[model samples]
Target: MAVNLQKGQKISLEKEAGGALSRVTMGLGWDVAKSGGFFGFGAKSQAVDLDASVVMFDESNRPVDVVWFRQLKSRDGSITHTGDNRTGAGDGDDEQIVVDLRTVPESVRSLVFTVNSFTGQNFSTVQNAFCRLFDTSNGKEIARYDLSVQGSHTAQIMAKLYRHNGEWKMHAIGENGSGRTFDDLMPLIVPHL
Candidate 1:
């Protein structure tokens, strides 16, 4: 049973999973919108190269590590990105970031998940976009955030997972920005940290 998360909503991962979570996964998915088609006729869908990234931050809100398409794993080997999906053509998750919760460094106080269009395509050309969290061991979905807000921004700071009283929790950020990569969006993401 997964909760459809609203923007700014927060949830306790431990309570949602019925116990401590050993490993978790953040899955990002989306689809390209079709254009130049008659009513219900043949329309050509544009290719959207969206990248999912996890930025690990310390108590001081300083980014300590990041796992993305280029950097597939964190320095400590606790987090790993599945791969990149150039075209959001298939169903389910287009990209996945797996986190071994137990192995995540104690110094890391928060993990921010983000998505950006590497090809500079804005959200207006994307549809059915979503970010979801689940237990990697059993594949039980815990929470899902719909990234369906269409706009001209090329990136979205989707959600955050932070430690609270020795437990992990989730917060849906749903902030939009104009950037083609994580480095370009760092300024916009710092305020949320």
Candidate 2:
């Protein structure tokens, strides 16, 4: 079972499953909103090339690595992006980033998951946007953060997974922002890291 998390809510990964998770996946999904048409039959919905990105930060809150469409894997090879999904036409997990929890560098204390519209469309043009965390071993969903809030912002700081006292926890952020890529979201994400 998965918990629908509210903004600012936190949950310990180990406590949620009664054991430590060796592998986890952060999945992001969304859909293109349709423009008006007769009876909503042939309405044209613009194809949005929204991107899912993960930024790794050290204890000092400095960015250490990133995984996205361009850079599909972190330098250390612990984090890997499945691939780029240019269209939101899929059923589930339009983009996925797999993390080997045990292999992640000890220096990297936190991982921030983010989404941005690479084609300039804002969240108002998107629907059913979501970010979810899953335990890879059992394929069980642990938590979900829905980015269903419509707005003019082009980006979102979806969630963050960080280590505290040797335990891993996840936090839902769900903040609307304006950016086309990870680099552009750095300023808005810094304060949150």
The residue pairs found clashing in candidate 1 are none
Q: Write the per-residue lDDT of candidate 2 for residues 118-138, one digit (tens) a residue.
A: 999888989998999999899
What are the TM-scores, per candidate, against the unseen true structure?
A: 0.98, 0.97
- Best-matching candidate per TM-score: 1
Clashing residue pair totals per candidate (backbone < 3 A): 0, 0
Whole-model lDDT values for every prediction: 0.94, 0.92
Best by lDDT: 1
Q: Which ten residues in a row have the lowest lDDT in candidate 1?
A: 180-189
Q: For candidate 1, what is the lDDT?
A: 0.94
lDDT of 1 by residue, 37-105 (tens): 799499888799999999999999999999999999999999999999999989999999999999999
